[model samples]
Target: MLIDALQCGNFDREVFEELKAGGFTCVTPTLGFWEGTLESLDELGRWRDREREYPDLIKIVRKAEDIRAAEREGKVGVLLGYQNTNLLEDRIAYVELFADLGVRVLQLTYNNQNELGGSCYEEHDSGLARFGREVVREMNRTGIVIDCSHVGDKTTLDVIEYSQKPVAITHANADSLFPHKRNKTDPVLKALSQTGGVIGCAAYRNITPADACATVDAWCEMVARTVEIAGIDHVGLGTDYSHKTGPNHLDWMRKGRWTRGVQYGAGSAAVPGKVAKPDWLVNIGALNSVEGGLRRVGFDEGDIAKIMGGNWLRLYEDVFG
Candidate 1:
């Protein structure tokens, strides 16, 4: 499983041990989000210190090669990433600095408009701003993978066409399957695939629209449709699981303007309760984790390999090299 991060506050040695026991070879962890200049640097410093302290259980991985090496060495590769550009603020040079610190993936925005682009929750969806374009260009130039999962539709399409290298929708779903702002339409999937980019299907229940509750079967059906529309080569997996977080975390996620009222649809009053929810809804089922998800979906060995890590690995090599 490619996790988001292993910070001291969010996760600790116990969690890393559990991940190792669960057979997670690597994770693209978030390093910066909603942080200011000094705070961002401090976060980096904290991670650096943790890296030194937990050399045996975890290691910072900067390139695709490092992932393979970690798998072979029986250590979890911690690939750094950022979910928002807030940390970058107005300075573009910070892109290179974060890349040097092992941040390979960066989403252009979070939930609202920033210097880079408008977010999916933004009211007008004004698309990428002037600075947004520069941010994409700078990321490409610095060999960092650009992500557009939380970005607005227009902004996502614009970046896909504008980027010199293939960009990824690191965690999203097909809007046709589930019509949420966070989900992409069929056309977007086609366009992303055409650019050699990969779309990571998120395991969040709210992403699937069939019913209020989601199950593994529902998730597999969604994945099947996405593969049919985008092709198997452009598909990948991103669980987006915050497993250890408490109920307060869910409240926090929903309190945001963009995320307000956006339940995973399981048991949601919006949909009829009779329809079986997507397997991901309960958080304890076949789709609970990456390995179990593939098994339940009946994906062959080759397809499982690609979705689990190969597709992302290929993209990283192309952009981060």
Candidate 2:
């Protein structure tokens, strides 16, 4: 039972093939980040066609039970998610509109500040704004899981405290371990676990480090340490996989329409490419390595199962079921 909390790859037929090869049972593929309402709708529309094109390979997951059914049926459960709430714009009712359209998860911010709040990369950390608070409530009311992987610490906590449902840092690592701005801080990890929120540790190089994931032993060591901080039930695989694509895709993802110049995310002026991935677990299909790594790290089978996908199922049950 392998499940990715989130993945933002240039998904295509080959990618879906790899997901099946990787033994992925379910995944929350990022559908939008900088896209506006029309673009978002078009993206969703593209998926509607894809579902018809590859009916056997995937199933659009509208509920938690759908994920379980996907596993039993040998199909990849597709949970539509977005990295930003840009499509919602200023309207709270759009929250339910998106949920009705099969969007099961939404992040408050991407890598830039918006009406909801600040992003980790932004200059100021605007702890949830008035509109942001309402967005949280509407997301709760609509049953969309709130994500904070790229959100600032303060805003992340703000949503967690104010939300009736548990929020998530869907694809990040432990900051105390890796010290990246995109990673969650120890305090945030503690608070997240306390409130039953889960943090799926990414296998991305910038956040988890390629060397740290060089082997099952090393990878499990990282997972063990994260579990030590966030608890077994709150740690899962988010894997943040970015399948290599055309050169311009990075520019669109990092800069969007907000910047005239390139904005390197988790990278800098010297190295302006996507972070390197370790060879062992490059795609979703290699996720079995994580289950092996956890066992090597002395995690009991039950705890290992929790880390693999059980925890996320429980979370989705609470918000999307």
Candidate 3:
């Protein structure tokens, strides 16, 4: 019952088949990032059609039971998620509206500041704003998971303190390991673990070490360190896999019309155009390597199970009511 907590790849039949073949029980697909309310809804509608188009391969998951049902039937459950709350804008009610639309996971901010809070790339973080706090309250009430992956340090801490329910730093790594802006600090990780929240370790090359060091072993070592800091129940796989995507998508992800000039995020400046993914964790199919890596690093079966997908399921059961 492997569950990938995050993957925003090119959504198609081939991708679905690959996930199905990889033994994925469920996955959270990012439906919103730079999109507004209407655009996000359009994306959601497309996903609805996809569910209809590939009924045998994919099913919509609004709760833990939906995930279990998909697993039982040998299909992958798709949990609708957002990488940014730009769609919510100033309207806090949109949280509930989108929650009703099956938006189970939402990241407060992307790489830049918005109505919610400052991004990780922002020079000065204002922490959680008044409107952001209100949105958090509504999300807590509506059962939408709070995500702070691309949020700034101060904002991440603020979210941990402000959220009534446990929050998630869904697809990120430990900054103490690689020291990237997208990675969370030790204090933030500790606080999240203390609150029973989970941090899904990402496989994006930018957040990890350079080149040869970005092997499955290195990632497992990072995970082991995370468990030492954040505890086993607070760690899992988010992967952040974005395979089969074109270069234009990368440009849009970084700039997103917010800047007239291109904003080279993380390792993009050196690579110029392409977004690099680690070879060992390239896509959902490579998830087995993660399990193997965990085993090599001496994580007992019980603890490895939690880090693989069980931890996220526990979180969903507690929060996705």
Q: Report the number of the highest-TM-score candidate.
A: 2
* Worst ten in a row by lDDT for model 1: 1-10
lDDT of each: 0.72, 0.88, 0.87
Q: Across residues 105-161, which tens digit of lDDT does each residue of candidate 2 receive?
A: 999999998999989987789899999999999988888999999999999989889
Pairs of residues clashing in candidate 3: none
TM-scores, all models, native as reference: 0.84, 0.97, 0.97
How well is each residue in 1-321 modelled by candidate 1, as lDDT tens digits? 343222212657776676666667777666655666677778778777878888888887887788878888878888777778877868989988878876778889876678787788778888888998998999999988898988888899999999999889888888888888888888888989999899888765556554423455656666767888998788887656554655554444434334546543222457422333244544322333545556676778787677767778888888987
Which of the predicted structures, 1 or 2, would earn the higher lDDT when compared with the native? 2
Clash list (residue pairs), candidate 2: 22-285
Error of 1 at 16 (Å): 1.0
- After superposing candidate 1 on the true structure, give the runs of residues whose Cα lies further than 4 Å from its correct spot: 1-9, 209-214, 247-298
Steric overlap count per candidate = 15, 1, 0
